[model samples]
Target: MPQANGHANGHANGHVNGHVDGNAAPLPADLIDPRQVKLHDALHRLRKLEAAKDIDIPQLIVVGNQNSGKSSVLEALVGFEFPVDNGACTRFPTHYSLRRGEASTTAFIKPGPGRNEVEKACLEELSRSIRNPTSFHDLMRAVNAGLGKKVGMERTGDTGKGFCDDVLMIERRGPDLPQLSLVDLPGLFTASSGHQTDEDQETVQEMAETYVRNKGSMVMVIASAQEDIHCSSGIGLIQKLVRKDASLNERTIYVITKPDMAQSFASLKSVVDQFRFPRPAHFLRNQDSGRDRPRSLASRDAEEEKFFGSGEWVGVPQAQKGIAALRTALKEMLWGHTKNQLRRLIPAVQDMTEEAQRGYKRLEEAGRPDRRKFLVDVAQDFDRLIGNAVIGNYVNREFFSSFDDTSLEVRYKRLRSTARALNKRFATAVQEHGKTVVIGRPRPSGRPHGSAPPPAFLAAEIDRLYSYPEPESKCWADYETWVAGMVDDWRTGEPRGQASSMAYWALFEYQSRGWKRMAENHLKAVWMVIDRFIDLALAEVCPDDGVAEALRRRVMDTHVDKLRLAASTTLESLLSCHGRGNSGFYDSLDDPHTSRSRAQALISKIAELPSLDGGGSPRNAPAL
Candidate 1:
């Protein structure tokens, strides 16, 4: 690693192009270009602060089909021939940052997902004193080793998963370099054979797609002239995005590699025609023909020149032929691209800054809370929210957002409303089937054809109440006779006159049985609503999901359950008074007509049903 190395002094500076070196010394003004330096500086700060979540930094990315000479193209641009031989596929992306400064190189591994903390620390230490392409291979070996992969295994894990999002960064500063930022991504592969599997193909494809989607990044799509362009996944990938976002047509550079070996230049005619509209214009370039062949940047350029100077591409424009011309065009385009992207970048940063400011101001003036007090405050807040929900007070916008977000929650959180709804439905059901005998109205027949059914969310009480069988009717001549038949026979010690009164009480008691059922059901229904409200209230008041769940289990589950049992017992005891289970059926003996008038009203209510005696038996039995 060297610092402040520049080419104007005329020496090979032992580094890639002057791109994004963060610690490099400033170059003299006469030989300076600030676009790459300035852009990279902003990105470096953004990344260092970890504030780039909403922004896309400008970069150059290399992507193409597998074995499409993608690595060769990256080498010509970045000026280093990496170790891609001996089954060394680029298993992950390599992000190169080169700058014009003193001669030096710094390399590091950006650990990918799923690594343990110890592995991350070890991988982080690989950056020290790395100066060349072989160091890159060593870094990959370290990543694989930390991943517990054996020495010879280059790609897949034991589970057959291959490729990673881990990025290898190499920052270099040298005299021979020009300022440029570039990334070499894994080549897109299709067939899942050998070390690579179906998973590997999807991983590489996704990685390629993600890079291309970043509008700030310029995509260089490398295609081998020897292979059919139609089959090239790199070209196909970019073309797909271009169709969706037409502007990417400008950001994409379709470069044809290995032209020296291509049997027919005419095969790429369609690709050339479709992609050449906005042009730096060249698609053909040759960097190397064999592994570890072109050792220096000088030799790589020489080979490209030799190939184009003769043969099929000789007629191709000088502007459209070699790596030198391609490099110049990319530099010019990237400068303009950086300027345009600033329009979007500036606003995003301003928004992020404004959000930070609001966050700071939004904090309470009180200092850090005591642990005990924090728990108490959370409990009080939950209590207040539950109180509000029980009373139908939907004043908190935040609570409403949580409670009404989904269709079910919208109508469930308000406890009072849920109770009222249950009560109304229960009242209607009682009216239809409450009396043993009705004078006018008949029970509804089976569900009407094509008619809408009751709401799917009706309370459990409603369904249970309907499921029990409707009572049958029997006939008797008059009230006294009916009472005589309904009464239990007088015991040996009991008086005969008291038998008529006791039997009459039993008759009226049996008729009011639906009230006990409905009242008991209403208690169960309200408790059901209470359970749902507690869940919603927890979400609204206690923002921490884990705490809300814990509170529900520890407090609400244990205590609320006991409260429900107590409440149900109290309601059932009260409701049992309506039927024979309580002391006795009480009615006014003062008005002689009072009992008869009430009995007549009951008859009118069920006039459509079979006529009935006020006592247990019907005067006219229903026909079979």
Candidate 2:
């Protein structure tokens, strides 16, 4: 291995044949073989850092379905429960340390569009969409109204349709162990059962999958034994993970929850036998236990200690035969043959003396005239590399600009038109299929033959439609909610909460009558927007050429690695915006409005076409 010699300045001291000499001059590019030169330099640097050992503490990522006792199990193991309320406790992946006394840092990992990021983007969108230049309060009202309508909310609130509110990270340090770290991820399915709850469920599922796919850390999946654990949605998640890189199997652990829910000791045995998962563990907790009454760290530790025992001992028996048996099974799992059954790979350290000696002599005399020609050729490679980079960048930029100025607009318009056509097609499709979207209002035995409604029955039918039986006032209320939320843009801010009101009425109307058509149209519009956004994004993120390629070559070449480091530092931030997980202008919805802010705002508001619920004023209604 090569080492960093006294000639600290790699460039000034100039390496000869890949070795840096304070007194020696750099060999001409024509004299050295680039391959040997590169290898020699790399070897020298490897020698310098060879003495340092990098140890990364393995992080255990714990996640599962909502209320599947995910947080409970983590709190039980890590010796503390994070803050739990009626709402979710963990919104994003957070790191927790077992190292005590020292302050544990709380780190949150969230998906794209964080709060500040989303807020800025939304504000920008609102500013652009709303035509009127109003006070901050009025602007907020319009924004709130837009958002409320989009999400079908009764009134506008502080939040919008973005999921930034769902992500958070928390870290805690423990005194006893410094090496162990745990990551708590948000529950898979949400506990909330609302109209958009399914969407939330899908989002959470995607988030979990993305986390799992990117997880360099180990994983512990907690599940309830009582739930139909083998359903497609449940098993699909597991199957997808098992198919990831081979290392996953070794790092994964399955935990069955709610052992206390079992009927008897025999049944518990039967349950464990049925799952047949290797080294599976079970936890017993009351089904109705309030999340607020979390056990203290010490108490949970004691309980864990009792069940699995310490690293050394086995748990004792108790009068509750089932509990004792479960503990015994768990202990066996932790320390007995079951654990040892899992295959593990530990690499054997090699003895370097013999091989180093054999390679050293050849490596020493490797820099002859023939090698020099090779080295020159290698250096020459940098020129072509840089050339390609320049070309790639130029082409990418041109394409990006083209997309932005022309291609993107064309594609967006096409997609928009397609989507709208599809929506219209769906309506035609429904009618062609002879599907009458009936208004579920009280009707006589049948419609009398000569009594015809108006030609503009679309709006009137929606107004009279009632999916559920209710009084006239309630029907009107539902209508208002429908009308207001329809066409409402939820990305805007509402200073005075009027946005919420507008959304309430708009969404109700939008969701009613011709819903299939509406959905088809909306989805088409969203797809078009996303597609254009993605195309423009791809264009703007052109690869940097000269420096990037130069650095790549240097890193590939010899002992002094200044080029690679310099190049990396130079390009990291610049290219970061183009990476796979990068966000675009839509994500930056709150950015300040640039051009036509008022027009954008006005267009967005007019697009919403807010309606009144029950065709009555909210100001006149008494509090429910």
lDDT on C-alpha atoms for all candidate structures: 0.62, 0.39
Candidate 1 residue-wise lDDT, 99-131, digit = tens: 667776666677766443333433544444243
Model 1: residues >4 Å from true position, as ranges? 1-36, 102-134, 148-161, 265-271, 274-281, 287-295, 357-624
lDDT of 1 at 577: 57
| TM-score per candidate, chains pooled | 0.50, 0.38
Maximum-lDDT candidate: 1
lDDT of 2 by residue, 404-477 (tens): 45442433333333334344433433322211222223323332233222122122322222122322223556
